[model samples]
Target: MPKMKTKSGAKKRFKVTASGKIKSGQAGKRHGMIKRSNKFLRNARGTTVLSAADATIVKKYMPYAR
Candidate 1:
Protein backbone atom coordinates (compact mmCIF):
# COMPACT_ATOMS: atom_id res chain seq x y z
CA MET A 1 0.00 0.00 0.00
CA PRO A 2 1.07 3.56 -0.59
CA LYS A 3 2.04 5.71 2.37
CA MET A 4 -0.59 8.10 3.64
CA LYS A 5 0.27 11.71 2.99
CA THR A 6 0.27 14.29 5.75
CA LYS A 7 -1.64 17.54 5.29
CA SER A 8 0.89 20.16 4.34
CA GLY A 9 -0.89 23.09 6.00
CA ALA A 10 -1.43 21.19 9.24
CA LYS A 11 2.15 20.01 9.26
CA LYS A 12 3.32 23.62 9.10
CA ARG A 13 0.91 25.03 11.65
CA PHE A 14 0.68 22.33 14.30
CA LYS A 15 3.35 20.50 16.25
CA VAL A 16 3.06 17.31 18.28
CA THR A 17 4.46 17.67 21.77
CA ALA A 18 6.43 15.16 23.83
CA SER A 19 3.30 14.25 25.79
CA GLY A 20 1.24 13.88 22.55
CA LYS A 21 -0.56 17.20 22.78
CA ILE A 22 -0.83 19.53 19.78
CA LYS A 23 0.83 22.95 20.05
CA SER A 24 0.08 25.96 17.83
CA GLY A 25 0.55 29.71 17.75
CA GLN A 26 -2.13 31.89 19.20
CA ALA A 27 -4.33 33.88 16.81
CA GLY A 28 -4.98 37.64 16.32
CA LYS A 29 -1.35 38.68 16.15
CA ARG A 30 -1.05 38.83 12.41
CA HIS A 31 -2.31 42.41 11.87
CA GLY A 32 -3.72 45.58 13.45
CA MET A 33 -1.27 45.59 16.30
CA ILE A 34 -1.76 49.32 16.77
CA LYS A 35 -5.27 48.82 18.14
CA ARG A 36 -4.36 45.79 20.23
CA SER A 37 -3.15 46.27 23.77
CA ASN A 38 0.44 45.56 24.81
CA LYS A 39 -0.75 42.96 27.28
CA PHE A 40 -2.62 41.06 24.56
CA LEU A 41 0.44 41.05 22.35
CA ARG A 42 2.66 39.96 25.22
CA ASN A 43 0.33 37.12 26.16
CA ALA A 44 0.15 35.85 22.59
CA ARG A 45 3.89 35.59 22.12
CA GLY A 46 4.17 31.81 22.48
CA THR A 47 2.57 28.57 21.42
CA THR A 48 -0.42 27.09 23.18
CA VAL A 49 -1.84 23.58 23.49
CA LEU A 50 -4.83 22.82 21.30
CA SER A 51 -8.11 22.01 22.95
CA ALA A 52 -9.05 18.30 23.03
CA ALA A 53 -11.76 18.69 20.38
CA ASP A 54 -9.51 20.63 18.04
CA ALA A 55 -6.53 18.37 18.66
CA THR A 56 -8.52 15.35 17.50
CA ILE A 57 -9.04 16.94 14.09
CA VAL A 58 -5.44 18.08 13.82
CA LYS A 59 -4.26 14.57 14.64
CA LYS A 60 -6.12 13.25 11.62
CA TYR A 61 -4.10 15.58 9.41
CA MET A 62 -0.83 14.48 11.05
CA PRO A 63 -1.31 10.75 11.38
CA TYR A 64 2.38 9.95 11.76
CA ALA A 65 2.99 12.58 14.44
CA ARG A 66 1.61 10.57 17.31
Candidate 2:
Protein backbone atom coordinates (compact mmCIF):
# COMPACT_ATOMS: atom_id res chain seq x y z
CA MET A 1 0.00 0.00 0.00
CA PRO A 2 1.10 3.57 -0.68
CA LYS A 3 1.93 5.93 2.16
CA MET A 4 -0.64 8.52 3.11
CA LYS A 5 0.25 12.09 2.31
CA THR A 6 -0.38 15.18 4.39
CA LYS A 7 -2.32 18.09 2.96
CA SER A 8 -0.10 21.15 3.04
CA GLY A 9 -2.95 23.55 3.67
CA ALA A 10 -4.36 21.44 6.47
CA LYS A 11 -0.94 20.96 7.99
CA LYS A 12 -0.49 24.72 8.25
CA ARG A 13 -3.93 25.31 9.61
CA PHE A 14 -4.46 22.59 12.20
CA LYS A 15 -2.34 21.09 14.97
CA VAL A 16 -2.68 17.78 16.81
CA THR A 17 -1.85 17.89 20.50
CA ALA A 18 0.09 15.27 22.47
CA SER A 19 -3.18 14.06 24.04
CA GLY A 20 -4.82 13.50 20.61
CA LYS A 21 -6.88 16.68 20.55
CA ILE A 22 -7.03 18.93 17.50
CA LYS A 23 -6.08 22.55 18.12
CA SER A 24 -6.93 25.39 15.73
CA GLY A 25 -6.71 29.16 15.56
CA GLN A 26 -9.71 31.37 16.13
CA ALA A 27 -11.35 33.36 13.35
CA GLY A 28 -11.70 37.15 12.86
CA LYS A 29 -8.16 37.80 14.04
CA ARG A 30 -6.56 38.76 10.75
CA HIS A 31 -7.99 42.21 9.98
CA GLY A 32 -10.60 44.86 10.81
CA MET A 33 -9.45 44.99 14.40
CA ILE A 34 -10.31 48.69 14.59
CA LYS A 35 -14.00 47.85 14.87
CA ARG A 36 -13.52 44.85 17.11
CA SER A 37 -13.20 45.27 20.85
CA ASN A 38 -10.00 44.41 22.72
CA LYS A 39 -11.84 41.75 24.68
CA PHE A 40 -12.96 39.99 21.48
CA LEU A 41 -9.45 40.11 20.09
CA ARG A 42 -7.98 38.78 23.30
CA ASN A 43 -10.34 35.79 23.30
CA ALA A 44 -9.29 34.81 19.79
CA ARG A 45 -5.66 34.37 20.76
CA GLY A 46 -6.12 30.86 22.20
CA THR A 47 -6.45 27.58 20.32
CA THR A 48 -9.70 25.67 20.19
CA VAL A 49 -10.28 21.91 20.16
CA LEU A 50 -11.94 20.41 17.13
CA SER A 51 -15.08 18.35 17.66
CA ALA A 52 -14.97 14.56 17.34
CA ALA A 53 -16.93 14.43 14.07
CA ASP A 54 -14.90 17.23 12.49
CA ALA A 55 -11.65 15.81 13.82
CA THR A 56 -12.32 12.57 11.99
CA ILE A 57 -12.38 14.39 8.68
CA VAL A 58 -9.37 16.54 9.49
CA LYS A 59 -7.37 13.47 10.54
CA LYS A 60 -7.55 12.16 6.98
CA TYR A 61 -5.80 15.25 5.68
CA MET A 62 -3.35 15.10 8.60
CA PRO A 63 -2.40 11.44 8.41
CA TYR A 64 0.48 11.71 10.87
CA ALA A 65 -1.87 13.06 13.56
CA ARG A 66 -3.06 9.57 14.37
TM-score of 1: 0.93
Clash number for each model: 0, 0
Predictions: Cα RMSD each: 0.8, 1.5
Worst 10 residues of 2 by lDDT: 21-30
Question: Candidate 1, residues 1-40: lDDT per residue as tens digits?
Answer: 9999999999999999999999999999989999999999
Clashing pairs in 1: none
Per residue, candidate 2 scores C-alpha lDDT tens digits across 1-66 of 998889999999999999888889898888899999999998889888989998889998997778
Instruction: Please state the error at residue 12 of candidate 2 in Å.
Output: 1.4
TM-score of 2: 0.80
The TM-scores of all predictions, comma-separated, are 0.93, 0.80
Runs in model 1 lying further than 4 Å from the true structure: none
Candidate 2 segments exceeding 4 Å error: none
